[model samples]
Target: MRRLGPSDYRDMPWKNGGGVTRELLKLPHPSEPARFLARLSIASVAASGPFSVFPGIERTLLVLEGAGMALTLGGAPEVVLDRRSPPFVFPGEAETSCRLLEGPVRDFNLMVDRALVEASLEVVHLAPGGTRTVPGTGSVLLHGVEGRASLSGTPLAGEETLWLEAPGPLVLRSDEGARVIVIHLTRRESSSSGT
Candidate 1:
């Protein structure tokens, strides 16, 4: 397991050069640094505009702060997302744009090379003195979103993340109420044949 804090994150300009994003973790393709197999980041949207396009990648996004925003994917009708909304998944190749519902917003994003793996994301809420067990098969990421928590026995502060590379069970506990984002990534059987 690896622990990553704010200092470990790197800020970079968006692919479209419209904004900036703090990249929390990224697994780049073996031969291509610009191409990633999996990536997680937080974007600060300061103005309403278009989203960078990433062909062959699948993306999941959720509002992490501020009021919310509306997304228009391709020709589909706008979809509204707020802090309470569940993570939304869409094709990275889609022509996407956003209009802030109210001022600026910060959003968490997860993107993966769909041909190589499948990904799932969810949020878990823990009340004071609560504990939860999460399946730890494949690649799992636990990110502390609110309050303090612990993975197994290691303390995790807000905005910190734990990356589990092996298969097992993970125990999360919090003495105070907290919220955590969980992400699971599974490699495709066909892609693993030669690795």
Candidate 2:
């Protein structure tokens, strides 16, 4: 398992050059650094505008701070999102744009190449002195969001993340309550055919 803190994050301009993002992790294609299998980042949206397009990527986004925003994907109806809302999934290639509800907002994002891997994102709440077992069969990323948490007895502070390459069931415990975002990624069977 690998632990990543704020210092490990890389700051980069958005693909569209409209804003900035702190890339927490990026798994590049084995032979092509320009092509990535999966990526995790946090974006700081300072103004309302169009989102960068990613032709073959699936995107999942969750508000981490501020009042949140509303997203208009392609020609679909606008979808409102806030801190309490569940993570929203959408096509990265869609014609997407957003409007801030109150002001600038910070959000967590997960993007996966649909043809290479399948992915899921969810938030787990732990009460004080609570413990939960998280499956770690594939690539599981546990990001601490609120309070303090421990993964298999290893302490994880808020905003920190632990990447479990592959393991059995893992215990996650919180002594004073906590909230965590878990991302599960698995390679597609067809992707193993050397495609």
Candidate 3:
């Protein structure tokens, strides 16, 4: 497994230009458009605001630092999320806005093309001993949310990520306790048949 660390994250302006977001990885790279399947990034929200819209995409956000956020999505009731809360999933096309709970907050985001990819995010409380195997199709992303860990023996520091394509039973182990974000992506839409 390969590792992407803090230094590898790309600093880019948000789609709405409200602030900047650090893009950790994009499946088709930063230059491609139509072929984008999955993307992972981190953004800091210093104030309450609206989120950038991305039609045909599904998004999940996990509070990595600070108090948390209260989100109003698609005319539904406002949902409050904190560091201990599970990741929130919503449609990218939905009208979404956020109200910070306390001060600024740092969050990790995962986006997948709704038409081509089905995605889910889960948090694992890892102990010092034992291995955690993540079974997935299409791709699996391991993010070290808190503390340090490893994927297939490759060291992943806090906030670092390891991307595995069509991964089988992947193993993760850590010497110290860790909090991990496991993103499972499966292909939902297919392309042309090989004829």
Q: In model 2, which regions exceed 4 Å deviation?
A: 15-17
Q: TM-score of the candidate numbered 2? A: 0.96
Clash number for each model: 0, 0, 0
Candidate 2 clashing pairs, residues 3+ apart or interchain: none
* CA lDDT of every candidate: 0.92, 0.92, 0.83
Off by over 4 Å in 1: 15-17
Please state the error at residue 119 of candidate 3 in Å. Answer: 0.9
| Residues 1-195, model 3: lDDT tens digits | 567888888998876655568999988623346757789998988778899888878999998889998999878899999998988989998989999999899998999877767889998888887578878567788888877887777787787888888767777788887888998887754532311
Local accuracy of candidate 1 as per-residue lDDT tens digits, 1-39: 899999999999876666789999999875568899999
Off by over 4 Å in 3: 15-17, 29-35, 192-195
Question: Residue 194 CA error for candidate 3 (Å)?
Answer: 9.2
Q: What is the lDDT of residue 16 in candidate 2?
A: 69
Model 1: lDDT to the true structure: 0.92
TM-score of each: 0.96, 0.96, 0.89
